[model samples]
Target: MDLIRDDDENNSISANPPEGYVEPGWPALYSALHQDPQYLYQPYAIWRFTLYWTLLFYGFVFLVTGLLLLLNFTKRHPRLALLSFALWILSSLLLGLISSTIVAYALAALYNAAFLRMSTWVPPLWGAVQVLLLIFSAAANVPFFTG
Candidate 1:
């Protein structure tokens, strides 16, 4: 979806005019009436981008952890090991609240799948933590069902 505006169709949402005057300066309410559409208009794209960031952060933790584990297998790099572990925990704590709850949940699910597939998969602990965070985020997203 274009963040700008469509050059094709004009916005048609309007109330009947009082007598014969055009309703002036209500373009803010009818955003597409002008030449720019607001961020909210592209819900799916906005959500996807936010989710990508959250997933990217989470995946970075797993990637770093896996690298550290590979180093441990070869020899020892205590400083790098500690730093990677710390970052993994921080990523877990921050991913969910960084954006929309639904986006966060989507990212967690994506991260889990990728982590599970790596040949030297990161340890399972981070994935478990992400699952729990996803539960919390999903609950937060559930509105009062009108059903």
Candidate 2:
């Protein structure tokens, strides 16, 4: 089943206002009045994207561990197994949160851009900001786990 419906014909925001309706000067008001049609699908999208990425990352970790085990590297270096387990735990907790937050904010920014009629550069700039946030979070988290 499709999580996002392509019913834009029914969901499109009206350009013309109803009789006696006064347009507000505030962009926030416009956003409130004419929300993105895809707003309803955002939760599902975020959940799916987060789950997909988290599982992919988890799989990568597992694959590496399996390869190490196959090579007898884990037996030679017992600490490797412990490190792998710690990485799994970190992926379970931190990675899930990060992916979900990234998906949520990215979708929100996209919807906001569409509804607000923001400049073309705005979405990419917002995406860059999200990437920076992810990098900062990873940098901050690494020392705690490593040291």
Among the numbered candidates, top TM-score falls to 2
Q: Which ten contiguous residues of candidate 2 have the minimum total lDDT?
A: 21-30
Residue-level lDDT tens digits of model 1 in 1-147: 533322226332122212333222211223345644322212233344444444555666556655667577444767767676666566654653454455434544554333321111121223445555765676677785323
> Which structure among the candidates has the greatest lDDT?
2
Give the TM-score (vs. native) of candidate 2.
Answer: 0.37
Q: How high is each candidate's TM-score?
A: 0.27, 0.37
Which residue pairs in model 2 clash with each other?
none
- How close to the true structure is residue 57 of candidate 2, measured as C-alpha lDDT? 49
TM-score between model 1 and native: 0.27
